[model samples]
Target: MKRVQAALQHFAQAVAAAMMAAMFLTFMLQIVVRYSARLEWLADRFPILNPSLYGWTLEFCLLLWIWLVFWGNAFVVRDRDHVTFDILFVTVRPAVRRWFIIISGISICTALVVSIEPTWAKFYILRLKKTATLSTIFGDWIRMRDIYSIYIFFLVAVALRYAWAVYRAVRFGVEEPVEAPAGQPTK
Candidate 1:
């Protein structure tokens, strides 16, 4: 399980990194193309220029942004880095803190479990729709569902993490470990 999780963590990080690079390259290419389109001098000088420069760049970037947001949530769960309103949690007694942690984990798990089916149905319906660029290029369409695959993975990943947390809370007291045994790994 640990090895599988490590692999998934590495894969997610790679995907995130690749998306960031692709977005940067796409934006830079767009900027160059836009400037070239504006400047008659550049256009006349470079006969090879496609003033449109893969008009799908914007839509692609937006798609990448969506995946990045969703995947980042999964990564946060893997790393246990999700933001918490810790002031109240910090002020509480340890026993109260355990209850708070367990309750919050249960609430999140409940919400996610409840929403999963409706969300999947909505995404299924969206499979009928095509992106603007695909619609323009091909009368037939690429399914929006295919584009949103990462989001489904992200939801399941975070939900499972929450469920695991709840299980851990039940088995082991929920007060976060503050000290490490000698030579033990942290986090």
Candidate 2:
């Protein structure tokens, strides 16, 4: 069981890293292409190849970035690296803190479940509509665009992670170790 969990964690990390790299590279490529064209004065030389095309590239790149970031968020939560109000927890008694953590985990899991269906529906609609670049006739679904794929992946991952967190909270009662502040007393 431990090995399986470790493997899953590693796989999630790899997926997140790959997505982030792809998003970064896509944006960088778009920037380089746009700047190169501008430097070469090709926009003036070729009326058809205008700077407006860069706007399309920017939109595509932004969408990719959103997908990558959201997809990676699940792994962030799994690792317990997501943002939190630690100071409040620290002030509470350990037993109370444990209950609070468990309750919060369950609430988040419930929320994720409720939200997933609608979110997936939205993605399905977009996919069915074949949304795509204005210049291209191929819709996102037909082209298998990253936006649709990544959104689906993100929703699934978030649901799974939150579900696991809820399971852990129930089974273990949320006695997970809290990291100490740097230079603080361990006890």
Candidate 3:
């Protein structure tokens, strides 16, 4: 099970890395194409020097960025990597902290689960809307629904993560989060 989970984690990280690489390359291509249209030498040589020819790059970058943020948060980022104002949580003892974790987890999980249907409904409506530039490349087949679909995955993944956390807290309880002194950094 541990091995399987580790492999999954590596795969998720790889996916995120690939998304970032693609976004970076697309952005660079946009820049090169934009500037090439301005340079007389290059413009004279390349008939396809119109920056507008690659207008889809902007939309593609935005799409990848949305996916990267949600997907990375859902699978790649660990719980501890999240920023939290945990003054109340950290002040409490281990037993109280366990209850806090359980309660918070349940609340978050419930909220996300409840939102799934409404989110799906919104996405369904979005299917009618095609992107301005991307449609030129991918044809009318690509809609706003396809670009934003990663959000649903993010919602489900986070809800499941919280559900798992709640289960673990119930089974073995939670320990206090490690903290450094007032001035020292956490290791």
Name the candidate that leads on lDDT. 3
Error of 2 at 89 (Å): 2.0
Q: In model 1, which residue pairs have backbone atoms overlapping below 3 Å? A: none
Off by over 4 Å in 3: 180-187
What TM-score does model 1 achieve against the real structure? 0.81
User: What TM-score goes with each of the models?
Assistant: 0.81, 0.68, 0.92
Q: So what's the TM-score on candidate 3?
A: 0.92
lDDT tens digits by residue: candidate 3, 64-179: 99999999999999987788888998888989999998999999999999999999998998999999999877888999999999999999999999999999999998865777
- The TM-score of predicted model 2 comes to 0.68
Name the Cα RMSD for model 3.
2.0
**Each candidate: RMSD to true structure?**
4.2, 4.5, 2.0
The Cα local distance difference test for each model comes to: 0.76, 0.64, 0.91
Residue ranges of candidate 1 with Cα displaced over 4 Å: 1-3, 41-48, 76-80, 134-141, 176-187
Q: By descending TM-score, how would the candidates be arranged?
A: 3, 1, 2
lDDT by residue (1-187, candidate 2, tens digit) is 9999899878878877776776677678677767767555776787655656555565566665776577667554445455555777777776777777677777776776777778776666554443346234223345334356666566667767666766766677656455679966343
